[model samples]
Target: MAGGLGSKKVDITWSTEESGLLMAISVKTINFKDGKTRNYQKNLTNRRGDLLMEAVTLHRRFPYSVLAAFFFLDAGAENDGTPKRRSTFLNAHARLKLFTDRSDPAGREEQFERFYLILLEASPNSVSVRPFKVGDPDNEVSLSQMLDEILELVAERNPDFYEFDDGRLIKL
Candidate 1:
C-alpha cells in the first residue's frame, strides 16, 4: 500500500511450520506510538528472513547446535521479553518460517537455539516493543547494530562456523 508520492509498498515474505529452521520475525512501524498498525505483519516476516539468512550462512561453518541459535530467533518460538499484544495491534500479525532446512535433526536444534538467543538479546528495543511505551534510552540503540554485534559474537566464538553480512546480522 502506498500513502502518497515517494511512498513504498510494505515488504513481505511467506514461510511455513514444516520448514524446520526458524519462522518469522515481524517488525511494525506505526505513526505516533499508538496509531493503527500498518505493515505490522511485514515487520516480523522480514525479521525472520534476516535470521534465516544468518543461520544458513553459519550452517556451513559451525555445528548444528550453533546454527540453531539463529533459527529459533527468527521463528518466534522462544518468546520471553517479546511485546504483549494489545487489541490494536493484534490483527496485524504475519507469519514467516525461520528457514526451510528441515532435513536434519542436529540442524533443526541448532536453528532453534539460534532463534532463541537472538530474541533474548534483541527484544528490549525491538520494533515490537513500540506498542508498550515511547521514549527511552536503550530504544535509541539501532537494531541493525545490535544484529551485527550478535553476528560478530557468534562468529568470534565459533570462528570455524558461519558467515553473516560483514559479520553483522540484519536487525528486523
Candidate 2:
C-alpha cells in the first residue's frame, strides 16, 4: 500500500471499502546466527529499524490502522549468550517494548499496535512454535494464540464495526 514513505508491503492485511486499512501485520525473521558474534543479535538493530519504518509509513497513511509486528527467531536464540549475559530473545523483548502498544491513532507514528516474538524449533520429526508478546516474555503461547490476540486487538480498535466474541471476531 502507499504509505508515508512511498510504498510498503505487509505480510498480512485486513481492510474494507468503508474503513481503508483496518489492520496490517509485518513479519520479520532472523533464522541464522552471525558469523562473528555467533548470535542472532547482529541483525537485531537493522530489523528493528525496518519495523519502525514500516510502522511509521503505515500509521501515517492510515492513522486508525492496527499495525502488528511478528518477529521470528530460531529457538536456539534463546540460548545465544554467555552465562552472565542475557539471551538474544530476552534482549529483543526489551528493545521491542518501547515500540509497541500504540493504542491510539494519535500515538507515536513509529509504534506498532502490537508486537509478537516467535521462537521456532524445527526438527526432522516435528516443528514447534512458541510465541510471546513484548511485555510477557516468560509466558509463551502457540501460534494460534498469538493470532487470536491480534484479532482481538483489531476488534478492540474497531469496536463499532467488529466485536471479539467466543474466540472469534463478530461483525456488528
Candidate 3:
C-alpha cells in the first residue's frame, strides 16, 4: 500500500474497484519476557510507536479508510508483576486507550479506528485466545466477537456500501 510517508505492507486489508481502500489491520506481537523485568513490556513503547506511525501513514493517504490495530502478548503478561504493581496487560490497556476510537474521517490521523489487545495461551493441546479493548479489559471477547466488531466498524464507516446485520455483513 502507498502511505503518506511511503509504501507499507499491512497485515490484512480490504478494498474494491469502486473504493481505493476500505479497511486495513496491522498486527504486532511481543511474545517474550524481559530478562530484567520478567514482563512482556520491554517493547511496549516501540510497538506503540510503530502502530502510531502506521496509522498516520495509512490514514493520511486514505482518511476514510478504517484502520484497526491488534497487539498480541503472552498470556502470562496478565499476571506478570509484583502484588502491588499493575500487570503488563492492564498497563498496556491504559497506554493504548488514547490511540484508539477514531470515529470520523476527519479524526486524528494517528488514532486507529479500533485497537485490540490479544493474549494467547498456548499448550501442547491447543491455544486459547482472549481479546479485549482498552476501556473494557475485563470483558474479554472471543475471536468471532472481535471479527464482528471490526466488520461492524467498517460498515459504520462506509454506510453507503455495507451494512452489519445479524452478525453478518450485507452489501448494498
Per-residue lDDT of candidate 1, residues 1-172 (tens digit): 1111222222322222323222222233322221244222334445555544554444433332223222112213222122654221222221323343233534542242322222222445563421111112122334455445445544443444444566553332
Question: Which residue ranges in model 2 land beyond 4 Å of their true spot?
Answer: none
Q: How many backbone clashes does candidate 1 have?
A: 30
Q: Which candidate tops TM-score? A: 3
lDDT of candidate 3 over 16-113, digit per residue (tens):
88888899999999999999889998999999999999999999999999899889999999999788778889999999999998988999999998
Task: Rate residue 81 of model 2 by lDDT.
Answer: 81
What lDDT would each prediction earn against the true structure?
0.32, 0.90, 0.91
Instruction: Supply candidate 1's per-residue lDDT for 133.
Output: 11
Question: RMSD to native for every prediction?
Answer: 13.9, 1.4, 1.3
In lDDT terms, which candidate is top? 3
TM-score of each: 0.28, 0.93, 0.94
Q: Give per-residue lDDT, candidate 3, residue 152.
A: 95
TM-score of 2: 0.93
List candidate 3 stretches off by more than 4 Å: none
Q: What is candidate 1's local distance difference test score?
A: 0.32
Sort the predicted structures by lDDT, highest score first: 3, 2, 1
Candidate closer to the true structure by TM-score (higher is better), 1 or 3: 3
| Residue-level lDDT for 70 in candidate 1 | 23
> Clash number for every model?
30, 0, 0
